[model samples]
Target: MSELINNRQERIEVMKNLIRQLHEGRDEEKVRRQLESVLQEADYSDVFLMEIQLMEEGISRESITKLCDVHTKVLKKHLDLTETPDAVPGHPLHTFLQENQALLQRTAHIRKKIAELEKVSEEESADVLMKIRFLLNELMDVDKHYRRKENLLFPFFEKNNLHGPSTVMWTKHDETRSYLKSVIQALNEAENISQKEMIAFARLAIEPAIESVEEMIYKEEKILFPTAMDLLTEQDWYDIYLQSPEIGFCLYYPEFEWVPEGGLVENVEKIKASDDKIHLPTGSFTLEQLINIFKTLPVDLTFVDAEDTVRYFSPGKDRIFDRSRTILGRKVQYCHPPKSVNIVNQIIKDFKEGKQDVARFWINFGGRFIYISYYAIRNDQGTYLGTLEVTQDLTDLRALEGERRLLQYDEE
Candidate 1:
């Protein structure tokens, strides 16, 4: 009732007491009443602050993890603000909301296919497996969504002193990730998958994962987005948008661009003033010159170090595979799918053993001739360094039967 209780420290203490009481068999209604007295009619990030404080006071993280969703349920009905955030098309929040909607649709399709299999004969179920597999594959693409939240958005929450929510949610992310993996594995292992097998996998693996994902989306839209909207400034959002491309987009890409009012549209200027020239054995190249050289290359190149870490990927005119800053420190094995990981490993093994200098894959993809190669990098002394992945589209080159001796301008 007093302003003194409104102090965040005091509120956190009250929160701790309330949580303890609730765990000690106090009446749920009374606890809800206590929350009602403290919360104003708005987004409640104080809940985040309270949990962060409790964890800082030596409470185990696992303890808070278990109570996160439970306490959110308790606080849900007591809060006045239950409206979904109003994010414009170009806004980052809108993109996330769109992705969640897409994920829900994919899950619904998965469930529907599984339901159809329940009543169908084994032959009929056979027809459903391909559809189920496709949907499940799309669902695994939720990784991009989760990675963006964990790497990009969560850091902002931590910066704004809302540490506990991010930590707890990250734990839940892992749980959902495990569930997703199980579902994928189930589909992968299915041999003659009967109608019964389809039903069983859906119930045991797919259903639980889908439920967890949907629940997380609910919590995020209800609590996380609102709290972020209340806390982050325009510049904070601009920084997030600029960095988002590094994590890649989820199911939905923004339909419009959001420009911060009176703000510069680029990253804080990073002039190459500190080191203008890069010296090499051949000669020296200016920073600008070296950058242009990489851009001028006809193929896309990604360099992986001896540590199996992605160091750099050239930004060419066109790229065949996506690379993000998040991939910088990630193991090369994880960059591929769960199945192709073995082939990748084998290639690396062959290279490391000096048995092979190159591995290549060429295919006709989407009516284009695509060539992919991995070359083992080594020093003049033949010491193993790393590997370089080079990809090129040779569609035009393959089609060229005649050569142009001179450059000539033709009338348009």
Candidate 2:
């Protein structure tokens, strides 16, 4: 904590010990005091090393995630935006920072609305609820921000063996997603909410959800981004930038065109790399043929692997439900509305337990009878593989009382 111990390695060790103490039930005030004292002489790298050391001590990333923002709140003064390096336009980091600023403005506006709602009468609250719902929808875009981090940025961190923070941050993302879902549900369930109910909803749902998002923004800027800047090279960042649009942008767009060096060559090589045939027991097909066959299927198909990560989805011309590359490798639970996640979990559990091999649901949507069925994809030995979700619009099929054996296209 003294200037005499200002050697980089010594400072990193002190910071590491301080973090371990904080985690091991040391007095919070004492640890914070020590951290503050160290920050006076500590370079930012010392703090980054602290995070790496904490994970090295065998602590779970989930546990670290809960503590990440707490410690960062204290370090905010030390890691000023003015002092941290700048990210260029179109860079993934720059886009994220801009989105956070946009989110802050939007959240501030919602808070003002919530303040006004405190005085409204029960009879007049319905109009206010509708307005609040729109604001909540805007805030819901946070998912795209978090998803890009999980799918694009996190993988690079893992590649460098900096797995703890990525895992920890993803857990926090799930928490924020859960909170957002509850806030949406609170708004949707009540048609004519009373002033008291509206205030209660704000207290119970809105504030916490927005606060979770804000805290995550702080963590990313104060700790995650700085460390990542030091860890990732230009090529690593370019790799993420190329994949950014797949998950979609957040509240802002990158106007400048930025391309990675050799990016086109790398992509072309990937395309040509899989030209060999894939042989199966029945027969063999080239990769291109297999891709076309999946796309040509009448029903939209999605395969969620045993790990619950989406491994594949067919690109039908008219998909019953929207599917995007963003969904590739994403957790199946996050793909659905949070309300239905429990039902999805139950179905997966039943499949794993061998209680059921299939689950089907049909709903009339937009005058179309949309049939959705989930089948447990398994091997001949009966081992659980994953879930295959097949969806089709059956409006025309149901109306047909008789089958026509011959194809006649004169009507066209």
Candidate 3:
């Protein structure tokens, strides 16, 4: 036992030293090799937490991040014993990687354009600058990638008491966000920036943001993810895997197969069976009956669970907003596209913390105006139960002149 503990400690020390060396500008390949050897021999999940700490200490090594991905591939292969096949093309990880591939290709094209701009005469750089800004706007997808992690992945980690890596990664994510904003602001404010100024801005803003992302990959693979794998049961991972498609991935695709635990599968089957009928406080109704009732009603409805998972969405045939069953059980953050995730998250947080009760929005759609409102649902003790989202097509409602004394029937 003593010898085993000593070996673990020695491996941890070596990992820390490699990170320190990388941070100090030592040969990256050499440090990476040393770290790789330690990782191969170590119980990866156990030591990954320590590695995350090293990354948090300012070691932004590209080689280390690359190796970390390699490590994940290896560990996943070793631990994956199920008969299920790998995720298909449209799987969350696959979709995420596909999106990332496009983003990376775009970034590369932008970099080349920026380089070409430097070569051109100062009198003709405006076009290139405009293209650069457009590229930056496209690059805003990184914010979406980060949101998937923060809202979906981080909550799982928090449930497991592994807050260290998630917190550090969130801080780094915010730094990247701020850097992107600063670069965009600088570009917008410059009426005529010299080549030297442009280069400086690229180095100061873009390079560091990219480096931070690389380092985040390191921390996730070496620490955050491994710890999650250790602490989370197979069912827990399966739940994440099932819901991941809605939010998407950051850069790389995880090509592993995930099979839910037998117990989880059984439980889910039970839920599905029971879903045929709903027992309310006053009465019971078949699922189909409930659906018909909600669709015929004047208002649309959506239900988010106490855990903030989007559990139910009433599909009114003429829904004021679009929704899909795919988004059911998804974190509310993932349901919205990247640009709106922050606002969604803020609303959810406020709702959960009991700081706010109602949020409303109005919009015009297809010549008809609509109103949407989210209400925090609570129990008798004021304990939050979930949220009720109501949306109504208000075009007719807004035009109402007076209360109708007699009912009129329209052809069905």
Candidate 4:
């Protein structure tokens, strides 16, 4: 009950105890009151460290995610955002902030539409629902926002040995994605539905989706960004800034350019040092040529080494599946959803045992026919090396009537 606030360790312990009380079914208001009385202000890092410590103490990540919002609400009042570090106009955090602002505007518009739908007559309800649906479609751009954070930002935190917060947030992102998908499906099926029924569905499904998105915004601004700003070095942020364009932005584009005062020192040096040509048994190419070749390839290629870790992925302009450099050292199984992880593991298992050389599947995704294939790579001695996953959009190819014998270039 008595702890020194100035001591970082003591603060972490106090915060962790308060969070455990919330998780153990204790009265939230009472615990919050205790928190307010004991801790004058909630430091962003303390909140994350508390979660990490709680996990170390045997609490599951799922439990932490479920209670994430509750504890965040409790700590929200005491957070001093004004003290959070400032990010310059072109910094990655600055861009993220800009994107969040744009997303907030979209969410505000959707909320207004929902409010209008509640008061509109049955005849007018359909129009209101249509507008809301359109807004939801626009709101789906948040996926890119989440992906940027997941793939670009989370890696730095993991490198610092701070994995708990990112893990919990990723689970929340998936939950939000699922809710958005379900609500969109419900809206598509509400053709003949009555105003009352539509409003009920909105409350049951749509509102939660918006709420989840807003909750993440709060978590990022108040907890995640401030913590990251403190933890990540100047060089680390510069690296993220360089790779950000590859994954793209969400709802906003940064107009300002930011280069570190000393410029890209180590990165440029590394590039110069690695500019030599690489020779293979059959052919050879410079590192730059090889990189561009991969980018120009028609298929999206991913290589998972024999250890099941993602070693490389091609970043073609029109990729069939989204991938980021964060996936480089991540396990392949973590790349898929929980339900499909078993299938992924089985494929890897069969490939390792020499039972299969190739596996293929095709699915219709958002009206596009997608073909995915996995092949086992081996050496001359038949030693297993890795799995190569190739994905392609086959919609146009599937619809081709006849092959053209004449050379032709497709118009842009």
User: Which prediction has the highest lDDT against the true structure?
Assistant: 4
lDDT of 2 by residue, 1-412 (tens): 5555557667777777777776787887778788788788776656656676778887667667767776776566676642545787877888889889988987898888888787777666666766777666667777889988898888877888777777778899999989987887666666656688788888788999889988888778777788788888878887888777666666676786565555455663664676668889999998889999998998999999887767788999889898766456556765675447679899999998899999999998887999999999889999999999999999988888966789888462
Compared with the true structure, model 2 gives a TM-score of 0.62
Between candidates 3 and 4, name the one with more favorable lDDT: 4
Q: Of the pair 1 and 2, which is ahead by lDDT?
A: 2
lDDT of 3 by residue, 145-183 (tens): 777778766787777656555665676678777876677
Off by over 4 Å in 1: 1-18, 21-43, 56-58, 76-81, 255-257, 265-345, 348-355, 361-412
Reference-based lDDT, each prediction = 0.78, 0.78, 0.65, 0.83
Across 1-412, the per-residue lDDT of candidate 4 in tens digits comes to 2354457787678878888889899999999888876567546777888899899899999999989989888877776443545688989999899888888898899889889988888999988887888777666667778888999899999999999999999999999888887787667655589888888887888888999998898888878998888888888888888888766667676787677666676675675678778999999998889999999999999999998877789989888778765455555655664346669989999999999999999999988999999999999999999999999999988888967999999997
Model 1 residue 193 CA deviation in Å: 3.8
Taking all chains together, each candidate's TM-score versus the true structure is: 0.69, 0.62, 0.49, 0.65
**Residue-wise lDDT of candidate 1 within 1-412, one digit each (tens)?**
5665467667667778887676667888888788767664323666777778778877778888877766777787754366778887777888899889988998899888878887787787877877777676667666778888898888888887778889998998888888887777666666776677678877887888898888888888888888888888888787777677666665666658776766455434342354687999889999889998998898999988787766788977667767654455445765675557679889888888899999999998888899999999999988879999999999988887877899989574
Clashes of each: 0, 0, 0, 0
Any idea what lDDT model 4 has?
0.83
The reply for model 4, stretches above 4 Å from the true place, is 1-6, 80-84, 265-412
> Candidate 2: minimum summed lDDT over ten consecutive residues — where?
259-268
TM-score of 4: 0.65
